[model samples]
Target: MDLPRKLLAELLGTALLLAVVIGSGVMAERLSGGNMAVALLANTLATVGGLYVLIELFGPVSGAHFNPAVSAVMAWRGELPRTALPPYVVAQLTGAVLGAWLAHAMFDLPLLQVATRTRSGMGQWIAEGVATFGLLLVILRAPPARVAAMVAAYIGAAYWFTASTSFANPAAVVGRMVSDSFAGIAPASAPGFIVAELIGAAVALLVHPLLSPPRAAGREAASPPSSPARHV
Candidate 1:
């Protein structure tokens, strides 16, 4: 696919993803009153559904990589052109911020508000690393036909299992930092999450090769590149 089209897909897909995440969080918080569990449950459901749809909608165009970590992994695997990584990351980040703004607008909240929700600490960082590692592992290992469902289901589960609610995507961290809603993470805390996620991605990359059997020589060249793991 052309670079422009691919970038556009990444941008649009990531934007819609953030909108679903932040918007659902806002709505869930409002309706759940003071019940944090209820609000989280609602947010998780919406994110799982929306994430599946976005990947299905944009997978053909850009492999629906709405996260910089995914794009980085793809490039390292030679599934994506190395030259394209910067642009893909840029698009995803831009889309994330825009998506947060869009969610605020729809809910009649102030635009560009900074998140004050602190999400820092050793346990939270560890949870983030685990969350990201599991996410990439699922993406790397799942069969193409089941990638979307597997990814969505894992994220839904991760939301409950991880202490930080699994903000596993670096682009997502940037996006959520722009909102002060229930789903948001403070900008001050974004760096730790980003670093942990990157470390998780690196660990996944190292372990991925061990999990898959090596392709026969020239076998890869003969076959078309497989579908990338859909990462929202």
Candidate 2:
């Protein structure tokens, strides 16, 4: 894929993902009368569904790494092109911030309010790692033929079960910090969340192979430049 073209696609995909998340969160709040469960279910479903489609739509070009952590993992796995990583990461974060800001504005919530919407604590932090690890593990493992489907399902379910609601993506966490709404992470707490995700991903990377297939033949040929198809 052409670097410029892929970069543009990645930017659009990230923006799209964040847009849906913010919109869904706002809608859930309005519809549920502040019911946390309702809001969370709505937000998670929309976010995961949007992500699933967005990634598929842009995967052929940009690898659909709407999250920086995913990009980092891709880099580690040799699936992403090394030189393009910096731009991809920059674009992803920028898109996330913009998306969150738009969500705040759309909901008539103050920018400052959006920036401080984080409720992170020790429990949430641990939840963050577990969710992110699961996400990365599925992306790394799988019966190559069904990787995307498996990833989307695993992510959606994890968001439902995990208390953190599975932020799962470091770039996404930072973007969330720009908003203090249902989607925001406290800027102060963002680093810890990011660190937790990295650690989780590392642990998953080490252990995932033991249970998955060793390789996927045709799958490897079409795999992203950075995501090596090492099942074993």
Candidate 3:
């Protein structure tokens, strides 16, 4: 795909992803009547559904990589052109921030706000690492046709299973840090989450070859580089 179109797809996809995440969190919190569990359930369902749809929609254009970690890994793995990595990261980050702002606008909340929900500590950090590791594992291992469902399902489960609620994507961490709501993560906590997620991604990369060696025929059959074929 052309670079401009690819960048636009990444930007729009990431923005929509953030809107789904933050917007759902805000709605769930307001409608759940202070039932944290109920709110979380609602948030998880929305996120999973939105994530799956966005992946299907934009995967054909830019690999539907709304996460910096995913883009970074793909670049390193030779799935993505190294020259495109910087622009992809910039587009994802820009889209993430815009998605946060769009969520606020939709909810009639303040245009910009710093998250106050502090998520930190060793447990949270470890949870982030685990979450990201699993995410990368699924992306690298799943057959191209099944990647979207697997990724969405994994994130949904991670939402409930992980103590840190699986802010596994660095761009997502940045986006969440801007919204002070049920799904927000404090800016102070974002660095740790980012670091932990990167670590997890790195580990996944190292381990993937051992667990699921690439097939010579499969790469040829794989979806185009910009397709949501094997990426999330």
Candidate 4:
């Protein structure tokens, strides 16, 4: 409810998310024995399960917005306070980096390595945009009770459908940039992914209203409270 507690929720939720992503990728790659699809599937399954649990665990406290793009959209929509945006983003980013470190510690890898996996080019950027747009759209439209499950499912689907493996969150991009493992993206590729994600968020914001118009004033009281647009 309070700002400090909300920030803590965001921090913890995001940290756990990154740990799951990076940790699962590491494990998947090792066990998949050079089969990229198998590794990706394992990574997707872990991420989906982890994300669902994290959202349910932290949603009541901080809306469980582990993604900065999601937070920015919430702030713009007046769901999250504008003054709190910076702190929320900072917490998510800090948590992401810490999560990466935690994964490395667990796997006995170098803690300060940079990603050299080159993930760039027009197709990748476009895929990033499409991935983020779908993510935000789902967040904006899904019923509150189903948010966690729907978001996780959408991300899992996106992981296979999108060219970039759906790194839909900028904080994820940052976290993965520092890890040269299966889930990592090269530092040089981070900017394009981040930019595409932001643009996709903006596009989702614009497109959402067209799909789900505001309810009539008389129906406002009957509608559920839309205070926070929760997302992963």
Model 1 over residues 151-219: C-alpha lDDT tens digits? 999999999999999989999999999999999999899999999999999999899777655774257
| lDDT string, candidate 3, 83-166, tens digits | 999999999999999999999999999988999999999999999999999999999888889989999999999999999999
Stretches of candidate 4 exceeding 4 Å from the true structure: 213-225, 229-232
Worst 10 residues of 1 by lDDT: 223-232
Candidate 2, residues 1-232: lDDT per residue as tens digits?
A: 3778877877787777777887788788889887998898898888778877886778766777787777777777677766777888998888887777677777777754445665578888798889988888877766556666777788788887777778888777866777656766777878888888888888887776565455653465466543332211
Task: Give the winner by lDDT.
Answer: 4
Clashing pairs in 4: none
Among residues 3 or more apart in sequence or in different chains, the pairs in candidate 1 whose N, CA or C atoms overlap within 3 Å are none
Q: Given candidate 3, what's the lDDT at residue 68?
A: 91
C-alpha lDDT of residue 55 in model 4:
94
Q: Indicate the TM-score of model 3.
A: 0.93
| Tens-digit lDDT string for candidate 4 (39-129) | 9999999999999999999998899999999999988877798999999999999999999999999999999989999999999999999
C-alpha lDDT of all candidate models, in order: 0.91, 0.74, 0.91, 0.93
